[model samples]
Target: MTSARPLPQYLVSRFHGWKATTYAESSAWYRRLVDEGQRPRAMVISCCDSRVHVSSLFGADSGEFFIHRNIANLVPPHAPDGLQHGTSAAIEFAVTALKVAHLVVMGHTSCGGVAGCHAMCSGHAPQMEEQTSYVGRWMDILRPGYDRVKDLPEDQQIAALEQQAVIVSLENLMSFPFVAEAVERGTLALHGLVQDIANGSLLQLEPSGRFVEI
Candidate 1:
């Protein structure tokens, strides 16, 4: 059990800030959209963490992004899971259905799953638990990085591996039939982004280790 004092103050403050925006949406506008769904221009794959919100980063409204959040923004190739992969579902809807112009797989700094990627190899990670659901499954995409940098400090590896995983996820996305066909026809653009959470910055991933400010 945890005490109230252990909670972070930012949550309290941000919730209040959110209420201001939540109140700004007129009821009639929401009703119109609810009855008739708005088509979003892009699909963003981001982490489920509360702090890494791509919608807020892009200044998008409720239905403006066909956003999908996982433990990390992982896109596994379409296989035997089901006809509906949540991340794949959003991408297919964006490209093949809505015909969105862009699809971005965004990574971020200070991710817990990046740390968990390191932790899993340490023989200390929890196994087969509900709370560990997505992290355990999705973080597998970063296994190569985790093994490569097992000796690095958590803070350093978080940025490095998160960016690497972003690229890897992008590669995985190409394996999907819809995404591949769309790219081949030049109908969609794929972007890889890294959000620098520490300095309140958004960094676009360079092929090198550096990320340029957007």
Candidate 2:
């Protein structure tokens, strides 16, 4: 069997620093969390971009949010084929088991995944069209989103597609029975947001299907 390598020195050092400072200051709070278990009120679906810090963005402490990160912050339509579906599994747990009050799909500007989807759909990224490309297949979920913004000027497409990622995920999330039932029962609410990385500004999707800066 292949053995895992030792942890990176930089990460190890950071862990030690956190333990001595942040963890030490909050040790009792941490213990209470471990004993009580997490009961976060919101489930956040966010991009896997390194710059998109979900906790920092929301001023969330540990155990404050149930977060799920993906390449494009996507939630595919419900498929009960018994295959592995990590995002769906997380959603199911958050909605059913955790009973989170809110589910938020947050996308961001300059998302590589959205950019790739635009490129692939625009016929500029032939490699992403190959069947064997996992990223290509995953980004296919955003093809419908691409079609929505394809006619816009080239400079505006990527930004619009980024917001569409959040919209698409929110739409797909409703395809899950548990999520839909919760929403119908008034036990769950869904929100969609897009963040601008450069200025740390947020845009929220309103009931009218338009994004307004907040």
Candidate 3:
């Protein structure tokens, strides 16, 4: 990249505005957070989509929630294969080190990753079949959930898959022994949620295996 193609003016200006206002007004809070490291009570695993803003939705202050975002907000089964596993590493830190009380797996509507997984599983996306495709392999985590909801109507299938993303992540989270031990000891709780992009409605999964608006 050339120096001429520098950072966008709009983003730079917005950062300046934020530094002048929000950061300036809360400098002490920022200092305290810096001095005393973060001890967030919950760990939120959410989709990479910008529309799903966990902090903004809950009006969370800094140092409140430990947030991790990835394509489809996926957590693969516990694989201690001595390889780098980003999501598993985050989960381990949150559960064993930070000792977060809750683990929330949040998904949302109109998720391109989930939609891509749907298409790939349905044999509609040929490119994803290639062994070199990273996205295709990552999205394979959602394939089991997709299989469960494939019989639904086309319009409903995507939405169901979105919710299924949350379920899949939650199930995978439990596969980590530390997370399950924490839950068993009453130190950690797991939650699954789906957010509607357009209307801003939230649905939480219940014990009965259904998501109801909350």
Candidate 4:
């Protein structure tokens, strides 16, 4: 791990036709999901990393989570002013149109994305001004979450911060008019969780540091 090396970028490039091949592989099951109108019960907000995959982690196939991912698993407040927001669009579809019974913002341990947010808050990360990368903008949504938990010890910092970010993201979700209406009408349930990837532990917060295992 001393010398960092990029992943085999072409490994995925070799699978360009895998999407089409998948349809042919499970044509019947996919058609069943599509024809069922994709009324998924839960929507998962997860990281964009191929390894930290939501589908494999949740044991779900296609159409399980009306999924959204970014540098980190962040849910920006549905604030769109001449900006194309993919996360907001996914939330709109899942909460309103799909009527997903639950919206879960799942954060995990040792995430590079969450680590980036932590670094930014600690002044270890470079300034984001004039940055053209999409990640910088996405990380902005998580800055407050970092501030919210920056006082904790390093061992507990990321888990605490990421867990709190899940809560913040859930709150941000409600900022969307559709999400607010849905939650107020009791059409959607908002949940937040931090995944302990090391031990497969799923800990939930109780408005305080008290973590009750679920």
Best by TM-score: 2
lDDT of each: 0.77, 0.95, 0.93, 0.78
Taking the tens digit of each residue's C-alpha lDDT, what string does model 4 give over 64-174? 778888767888886779788888888888877888999888877778877777877688767652278456667888888888787888878887777767777877987
- The window of 10 residues in a row where model 4 has the poorest summed lDDT is 127-136
Q: In candidate 1, which residue ranges exceed 4 Å CA deviation?
A: 1-28, 81-84, 122-134, 147-155, 207-210
Per-residue alpha-carbon lDDT of candidate 2 for residues 10-81, written as tens digits (9 for 90 to 100): 999999999999999999999999999999999999999999999999899999899999999999999999
Instruction: Answer with 1 or 3, whichever has the higher TM-score.
Output: 3
TM, every model: 0.75, 0.98, 0.96, 0.81
Candidate 1's C-alpha lDDT?
0.77
TM-score for candidate 1, please give it.
0.75
Query: Candidate 2 — worst ten consecutive residues by lDDT sum?
Result: 1-10
lDDT-sorted candidate list, best first = 2, 3, 4, 1
Tell me the spans in candidate 3 whose CA falls farther than 4 Å from its real position: 1-5
| Ranking of all predicted structures according to TM-score, beginning with the best and ending with the worst | 2, 3, 4, 1
Which residue pairs show collisions in model 3?
none
**TM-score for predicted model 3 compared with the true structure:** 0.96
- Could you give candidate 3's per-residue lDDT for residues 99-147 as a string of tens digits? 9999999999999999999999999998997889999999999999999
